[model samples]
Target: MLPLLPLPHLNREFDYLVPAEFDEAAAVGVRVRVRFAGRLVDGFIVGRVAASDHPGKLGYLERVVSAERVLTPEIVDLVAAVAHRYAGTRADVLRLAVPPRHAKVEAEPVVDPPKIAAPEVDLDAWASYTHGAAFLDAVAAGRNPRAAWQVLPGEDWPARIAELAGTCAASGRSALVVVPDQRDLDRVAAACEAVNGTDSVVALSAGLGPAKRYRRWLSALRREVSIVVGTRSAVFAPVRNLGLIVLWDDGDDGYAEPRSPYPHAREIALLRAHGIGCSAVLAGHARTAEAEALVDAGWAHDLLAPRAVVRERQPHVVALADSDHALARDPGARAARLPAIAFDAARNALKNGLGVLVQVPRGGYVPSLACGKCRNPARCRRCNGPLALPSAPGADGAGTPTCRWCGIADANHRCTVCGSRTLRAVVIGAHRTAEELGRAFPGVPVHTSGGATVLDSVASGASLVISTVGAEPSTPGGYGAALLLDGWALLGRADLRAAEETLRRWMTAGALVRAGADGGRVVVVAESEIPTVQALVRWDPVGHARAQLDERIEVGFPPAVHVAAVDGSSAAIAALVEEAALPDGVEILGPVDLPEGQRHPAGGGSGRDDGFDGDVQRLLLRVSRGSGAALARALADAQAVRSARKNTESVRVQVDPIRIG
Candidate 1:
């Protein structure tokens, strides 16, 4: 019988002897139902054995899931290495490697895939691709552009991408392309279909129904499809003769799995490509330091467009930093979504038949509020809470909003600083932006892109679109102007990556600016000259990443040191820290309390600087990477030993966490 374990559980893999009664059912890579400690569990056969590890008798293998093996030898080996590197169990890594049994077992009708079947065919699907055909051809031939590349300025990208997909189809090899999210998948998938034709491609995503997902997965493993495109988890799609691996937005946090081992798609791509020696491209308008590191190490060539091409495509972005550049800028443009100058710009663009994209601080109607007199926010009388918007509309055709913490109304709100009750909204959301623009532009249809909505809502016309970061809407006619607002929202975060991250966001929003006859107007409000701002103004993300790395190297931050986070109750955290067998040279940033205050995203960890408990625990541990595998191993060993002790489970260990204060 198979060993019993929880869903996605690691630390256990059962060994079952093939029973003479059903020897046909047992084979490497086949899923079998097994009797675990107290219950039936689903598990794959990593190996079949004649003898049992346990002295007692072993049970017969359960029914086989399928005859064809899905866990290819190459992938299993990769899992082994990952298990060792992350100091995790085999099951943990495979949880990511293998699809959920439910998602697979319950099947659905397979859609006919599109084909630009030959990777070398250039069908002009990618809008406005200048050298897109040539670039696609080169990538298919396993060549990388030695120069910088730019996103061609229009709708032809589909044809360009389809023309290139021909390369994969030609070699009778399969391919997997991973983007940051579902929207990108849609954009690329359409292009793949247009160029490749029908039945030649399939999309693998968690978004699909389980049964249908499993069918596609099984088909891919059996080499039925030549191209598989998806988000992060698709990294493990079972494509046969894997030929090409393409990843866009490598720096996106969405690509990082929140589960154990926290394996990132980028790391997986690098390893997968190396294992198969397939042609690979890590492409995005912005570059990550990790990608730059790959370039520095001679792993991949830097695909780029010429400087003139970049200049022509991207607007002449300028930073508006007052001497110090409120460098502390708000992202939502709360003070005024349309400051006179920016509003005027938008008006001009729209009147001229150009679409405009307005980025807001948050996605909802009201994310934050404060008192005008004292700049203190109103709170709920029932609970020590900040206010929030409700889901249903109020009497005024607006949704009801309330405080998430201590659920209460702001009818009796007050400003503690001045002992006054006059409170004003401090932050603006996408909904508010839409509302305001609807009134300001009068009859200019405004759409929104955020949360679960796809980018398709945005149409090809001179309409206004309000968006938040990742969900920026795409325009068919393309945007004539884009308002990148609330610089502080991007800059003021306490995390180290705040500036770098914010800059990337601004550039991403700004990238949608229309290609003007001359250089277009891309006015960024953050103070100029700050590295991140400069990178935006100059369109130099690569340089920005490198410069940021240099700072990290100097300060011994990540990329220079290995890091981990242990957060929990004060006693539990203290106990773990005291008992931890942490390696030497480890630095602890805090035993300091996380906010025990009212609930809110900003309240993740309350501030003692203001009014917050200091007893709640959170701390950062950093060790030099120069220590090599030995150190990582030792640390993981320590974490594991401590973690296995049963006391550590209460305190989470996040290796290489992105959200650190």
Candidate 2:
């Protein structure tokens, strides 16, 4: 029996005797209740054995939870593999894999799955890419063809993904597609429904609440749905005869689980595909360094459109620093939020009766404020957090400075550096940008989409829409032009994926505009010399990703080498390192104190203040690619040792963390 214990030392299975009354119901893969250490606990029957390996007599299971066989052998093996890879307990992984039991749903009558004819595979959609047709043919022929696909701008990606699913279903196999969020899930699910029928595809996501989500999950578990589309958690869906697994926009942070034993949906899909001997596709407008690494290792082939096709489909991208002459013509362009070029683009689009999109980096009215005289950043006196003006001004026609972190208002504040009360906006947000654009273009309806009020789609008419990063709204015939403002805000982050992520957001928003042939234009407000800006201008994400991957290899970062971050109090971190028999040539970096409110890369929060009251520090462990498995095992064993000793101090171990800063 596999006891549902999260303790590291008790990760293995235990022997249990089966009572004669429950012999028929106590089958393998069924849930059971057993008395473990004088307390009744839930567990699963992993296997049946005639002889006992333990010297002591085994105790009988208290009772069977249900006669339904929920866990499958394949899932059991997959969970074990995932647990070992993440240096976590199987119980922790299982918690994410299986949903809580819903007795009412399970007891409901079983019905036959809806019968629908599979939609014909459309090869024309895949014809744009070099080997796209070949990839689709391989999947239809039951052959595995792993690929990292860079989708063309303005392509109906959901329809293409659904076509792949339809191809798999026509071959009498199942397909699992995992997206990053509810918006993508709805789009893909709708496309799948369009291909097949509404009842043929199951949509799974956390926002559906417990009951509805479990009902959909049960449909997939019972093989009633051949195509399943969902968010990150759906990666572990128990679909039978899996033929293909697709992950869209794998670089999005939503794919990373913010819980213990944090696992990325991309990696999970890869693992599941490899284990099941099925085809896998990583489709996105922008390529991630990890995806490029897969191509470099020869594990996956690249699927990209021809240069001419890409150029025809993409917008005419321009950076303010593209030419010194242009900057010289408007001397204030460098400092002005909305320069002459931007105004010209917006005016041209508006004249054509087309909508315009403005993408901002921040989302509030004045995300950052500074002293007008001394040019020093303003901070809260209570918590030392940054100060900003609220979305609305005060009754006196002037806005009061408020602490963003602590939410404290400071109406009569004086600059600490210059003893001045005047304030200036260091970084403008979507709301302020919207207000400014409304004034710049009088009578041109201006709308804002960000923060708590995000619009999914806006009318494709003559108007101005200001949004922050991922919150950009879609229009019917696509926006006429796009204005990418404040490039420094995204490119200046301290994180390693700053450039990669910035390029992704830019591409996503830019793709929504009309093609350059149709008079679509994109203006970026960043230095032309910056490599990221140049990549955007040239519309060369593949080249940028390849260069970034090469740089990571030279610097020995992730995708080239395996790294783990151990976070905890100083004593706990020290003890873990000393206890673990790490592999040879393991490099250790920094046990530096983490800044206040800074979370670990794996989503681990500040160190738990149980009995120990010490500052939290993070220590990084690096090893060669070949030694990654060894490093994971060593860390797991060290954690097991700590669990056995009943160590009260808490420590978090995360391998190949999402962020390394």
Best candidate, TM-score: 2
* Model 2 C-alpha lDDT per residue in residues 1-661, reported as the tens digit of each score: 9999978999999999999999999999889999998999998999988889899989999999988788888789888888888888888888888888888888877667666465766667789899888888898899999999999888888999998998888788889999998878888999999998887799999898788888889888888888999999899998888999999999998887766577788988888888889999999999999999999999899999999999999999988857888888888888877788889999999999999999999998898999999999999999999999877586785568999899898988789888999989999988889898999999999989988888888997999999999888889888999999999899999988899999999999999999999989999998889999999988999999999999989999988999988888888999999999999999999999877555544344422222235687889999999999899999999999999999868888888878765
Judge candidate 1 at residue 346 and give its lDDT: 79
- Model 1 lDDT tens row, 107-143: 4444443333454343434323455556656656655
Q: Return the TM-score for each candidate structure.
A: 0.84, 0.97
Query: How does residue 117 of candidate 2 score in lDDT?
Result: 66
> Any idea how many clashes model 1 has?
66
Error of 1 at 201 (Å): 0.7
